[model samples]
Target: MTQAEANPRTMGQQETNLGLSRALPNGSGTEELVPSRYAVQVGEIEVLVISDGVLPLPTKMLGHNVEPKERAAWLDGMFLPPDAFDWSLNVVLVRSGGQTILVDAGLGLDPDLNLPRAGQVVRRLEAAGIDLASVTDVVLTHMHMDHIGGLLVEGVKDRLRPDLRIHVAAAEIRFWEAPDFTHVNMPPGFPDALRAAAKRFAAAYRSYLRPFDEEHEVAPGVTVRRTGGHTPGHSVVRLASGGDRLTFAGDAVFAVGFDHPDWHNGFEHDPEEAARVRIRLLRELADTGEQLVATHLPFPSVGRVAADGDAFRWVPVFWDY
Candidate 1:
C-alpha cells in the first residue's frame, strides 16, 4: 500500500488536502508554516526537492558584521524585513534519463512530535505526480534529521521500499556516527542541531548506508561531487541530460539573504571550513554555465551563481515545468 494510504486518519482524503498544487511561478505551496517551492525538471531532466516545512529561527540567523547598528544596517542592506530567520527544509528528487533519484529525505513524524506538517515530503511528491516507492536510488548529502529523516514511513519499516542502491559519502557517515564529544563547548556560529540530528540519523543509517566516494556516478546521468566542510562528509550532486547540467547544490546555500556566497548560514558545524567550501563551490558554479538547484534558496530553488566583486549572488533561471 502507498505510504499515504498506510495512514489510518486520512485514508480517503482528497489530493488538494495533501498540498498537491503549484502556488506561484515556481513554487509548491502547502498550508503548513510558510509556503515553499519545489524544483522539477533541470533542462529536460526531472528534478525536484519536496519541502517538509520551515524551521522557525530568529531573524539575522547568519551573523553579519558585529555592532548592533551595523547588523541592522546589514539587514536593511539586504532588504530583510524585521527580525526574521528561518529555513525551509527540502527533500530532493531527481529524474534523469530513465533513472529516478531521491536525495535527502525529510523529517518523518513520530508519537512525540505529532506535528501534522512534518512528513509531508511524500505527499508533496505525489502532488507533483511522483511516486515515492518508484525511487531508484537515494543519496544522502549528510545524515541530518532535516535532510535524512524522511526515509521511513510512520510505523511500518518493511513497506518503505526503495528499489535502488543507496549511496552515501564514506567519510560523511563515519564522521557523524563517530563517538560524540559533547563536553567541550563548540565554537560560535557552529550548528548544534546538526550534532543531535547526526545522532538521530545514525540510528537509521546503521541499517541503510552504503559507501560512496568524492566522484562517483550515482546513476546514469547523475554524479555525486564531494563539497565537504558543512558536514565532514557533505556532498553535492550534479544532474545532467540533453547537454545541460544542473547541480542539486543542497545546503551549499541557505535561505535567501544568505544566498550570497560569502554569507554562511548560522547552522554550519565548521564555519570557516564551510565558508571556504562555499566560496570555492560558488567559484565553480560561476565558471560552469550549469544551473544550480539549492534546497533552501527560496523554493524551486534553481538558479545560477555569478561573481559580484568579493562575493557571489544567485541568478535564478528555472524555466522547465
Candidate 2:
C-alpha cells in the first residue's frame, strides 16, 4: 500500500489535529507544545510541510552584498534581531500518483557545526507516522548539505527502501563534483562543512541517483526545473493538479528577496546570476498567484507572491483549519 493509504488519518487530517496525539521518538504518548506540520491539499495530491526545526545564523547571510546599515535597517523594520536569527528549515512530503516524494531533506546531525536544533526531520517524520521505507522517490532541489543531510544520518539508509529512486538535476550533480566558492561569502568553516557533507552524501547514495538534464516529471503534475544561480544547478519543484498549483522554490527566493530581489545571499556561488533567477521567479510567481513554499521561509512557509511596485510582497495563506 502507498504511505498515504497506510496512514490515512495523518494524510486525511489537517494541521489543527496534528501533534495532539502523535507518538514521540522515545515512544512517549503526549502532545507537543507546538505544531510542526501543516497539511495542504493541491487537488488530488497531498502536500505536508514539516518543520525541520530552525538554524540560528548571522543576519548578514541574508544579504551579504548590501551594506551593513541597509541590512540592519531591514531587520529592524521587520523587528528581527540585528545580529542573528533563526532560519526556518522546512521539508516537504508529497504524495501523488501512488508515490511518496520527499523534496529536500533537512539538516541532519552535524555536531561540529553547533547547530543543535536543526536536524529534526527524521524525528518529525516518525512522529507523523511516515515510514522511511515507504518513501518511493526523493527529488532534490539541490545537493546542499541542508537539503540532503537527513538521508546521510546514521541508520537512515538502512531504513529506506533498497530500490528507492533519487531524482536530481544532472547539472547539480556535476556542480558539486568541483563546486565554485570564489563568489560566495559564507561564514567561517561553512564552505568546508558544506563541501564535506555534500561529498559524503553523494558517496553514500550514488547508486540510487537519477540525474535529469533540465526538467523531470517524477509524478503526475509534479515537475522539477533547473534554475542555476545559488549553486551551478539550483532548481525548484512545481506541482499542479486540478487547476490548483504550488511551487517549492528551494533556495531561489528568501524572505528578504520579496523586498530586495537583487541582494546576494552569502551562499550563492554566482550572486549576480542568482539575483537574476530570483527576480524572474518572483515575477512569475506574482503573475500566476499560485502558492509558494521554500526551504528557508518561516515555519510552514506556504504563501503567494504579489507585485508591489518594482519589488514583491509575500502573502501567506490563511490557515485552513
Candidate 3:
C-alpha cells in the first residue's frame, strides 16, 4: 500500500523484520506536549530534554536502501519501511552552577514547522524550572528551520533576545540572513520538508536569533565549534570543566545515526561533505572520549560514539539520557 493509503493518521508502527517497532515518537510531524522527565546530573552539568513535539511523516525522506537483508529486514536494516517518517524535535536545557543554557530552540510558532504542540518551547522551558528570561544564553548548532525556530516568542514580552547571548557560526549567520536562499537551486516538487525548512530559515534570520561565529564561550565550560554540513554555518558544542567534556553533535547524524555515514538527510547542503564530517567527528569524539549530543536522536539526545564491528554506533550516555 502507498504511504498515504496505510493508516494515514501516523500512529501505526512500522515494525522491523525482527519486530523492532519504528513508529515516529510522535505521529504528527509536529511536536506535541509530552509528559515531564527528570533532570539528570552529569557530574557538574545538569541536562533536561523537553519535548517541543515531533514531526511524523509518511515516508523516510532520507530513505536509503540497505544491503544484506534478513527476513523482514526493513529497508536494509535502519529505516522503517513503507516510506513513512517520524522525526522528533527537542530543546536541551543545560545547567551548571547557577547558569542556565538552552542548547537549541524548537519550532516556536511556525505552523509550517508542524511541531506536535505548535508553541511549546515556553511550556517545556518552564516545566524544567527554567524561565525564558533567565536562560543566560541560547546556543544554536545551525540555522535549519527546526533547530533555530524556538529562539523567538510571539508576544513583545516573551521574546528570546532579551540579553540572551545567542551563539551561531559565522557561515550560518551569513547564509540564512542573506536574502537569496528563496532562489537557491533546488528542484521543483521537493517535498514540504525542504521547502518549509528553507522558508522557515529565511524568516528566522530576518526576525529572530542572534548571529554568532567560531569560538564563542556562551557560558562557563561551553564553547561552540564548527561542525558545518547540514548548513554552511552548522556547528557542534563542546562543554568541559574539571574532567567532564561533552560535544553537542547537532544533526551530525539522524535517527539511526551510526548505521551508515551515508545515512545523511536530504537537507544537507552537501551530502558527501556531511558524511565526511560524520566520520571525522566520530573519530574526534572517540579519541577525545567526549560526550556527544544529537539534537534529534531520542529523548535526552546525548551520547557517545562506540565502535560496532566497523562502523561507529551512537551510544546514549547516562547523564544526558
Candidate 4:
C-alpha cells in the first residue's frame, strides 16, 4: 500500500499546508513546501528525479504546426491558460555499479534570458545530500542550454572531480559547432542564447567530453542511446536491472505528445523526425510497460505509457513518499 492509502488524513493535511504555503512571498526563507526531488528504486539501481524548476513558455511553443484554435481548444480543455504555461525541468541522478551518474544538468544562470526560476539543480542537489564532486559521469541527451547549462554555472567545474566524464553523442557535439536554427520556431533571443550557451559549455569542458557514436554504457544498467530526432544527436537513457526498467526520454516526448503525437514543438530542430521518434518511443514503452520519465514532464515525472486508440496515454505512478 502507498503512504496515502495508509494515512490519508496526514496526506490531506500535508496538501493543505502546501496550498497555504504557495501564497507566501518568494524568497521568504520558509522551507520549500512543494517537493523538489523524488526517489525511485529500479531493482538494485537507485534513481532520483530532481526538479531544476519550471520554465514559463508561450503556449504556441507546444505545437507550432497545429492551428491556433486547435491548440487553444486543447489548452482550454485542460483548464490551462491559452497564452502560456510552465514547463517542468527535471534532472535525474542514478547510482549503479559504484558510480553516480547525472543524466542532464538543468538550466544554469542565464541572466539575459530572464528565466530566474530555473537553475536550482546545484542547490537542490546539495539539499538532497549529494555533492557535486560525487558525480562520476554525466550523460547528456543533447546540447540544449537547459540540459548542459548547469555545468557552466560559476565555480561548478572547480568543485567537480578533475576526471569527471561527460558522455555526449558525437553528432551532437559536431552539430553545435554550426547549429542550424532555420527549422526551429523559438521565441526571440533563444537561438542566440542557445548557441552561446553551447559554445561556452564546449569551451569550458573540452577536456572532459567523451563523445560516443551511437550508444554508451556509463555504468551497470545505465545506457544512453542516440535517437537523433529533436537534435542531430538527441538520445535517451535506458535503465534495466533485475527485470525492472525505466527510460529517461530527454526531449523526444512531451506532455501533449500522448494526445497529439504528431504536433511539432517549437524547440524541435527537426520536428518531423522528432514526432516520429516520439511515436516510436511511446509505442515501445507501452508495449514493454516500463516506467517513463522525461525532462519537460510535470515534476516527479515518473509514469508508464499506455496505447490509447491511435494515440497514447500517460499513467503516472503513485508517489511513493
Query: What tens-digit string does per-residue lDDT give for candidate 1 at 154-186?
Result: 542344563456788988877776634332223
Return the clash pairs for model 1, or none: 37-300, 41-47, 59-84, 59-85, 106-150
Clashes of each: 5, 0, 19, 0
Off-target runs (Cα >4 Å) in candidate 3 are 1-38, 63-81, 112-119, 156-161, 178-211, 318-321
Write down the worst ten-residue block by lDDT for model 4. Answer: 14-23
Q: What ranking emerges by lDDT with the best candidate at the front?
A: 4, 2, 1, 3
Q: Which stretches of candidate 1 lie over 4 Å from their true place?
A: 1-39, 64-68, 110-119, 162-164, 179-197, 255-260, 318-321
lDDT tens digits by residue: candidate 3, 120-202 = 66665553334466676678887665665665455523544456566677787676544233322332333344445546555
lDDT of 2 by residue, 1-321 (tens): 112322325433432222223443455323566668777778777788888989898999999888999999999999999999999999898988888899999999998998888999998888777788889999999988899999989999999999999999999898889888999888899999889998998899999999999899999999999999998778899999999899999999989999999999998999999999999999999999999999999978899999999899999987655
User: Could you estimate the TM-score for every candidate?
Assistant: 0.76, 0.92, 0.73, 0.91
Judged by lDDT relative to the true structure, which candidate is superior, 1 or 2?
A: 2
Which scores better on TM-score, 1 or 3? Answer: 1
* Residue range with the least summed lDDT across 10 consecutive positions in model 1: 1-10
lDDT of 4 by residue, 1-321 (tens): 122411223334332321212223443323777878766778777777889999999999999998999999989988999999999999998888888899999999999998988999988877655778889999999999999989999999999999999999999999999999989999999999999999999999999999999999889999999999899999999999999999999999999999999999999999999999999999999999999999999988999999999899999998864
Q: lDDT of candidate 1 vs native?
A: 0.62
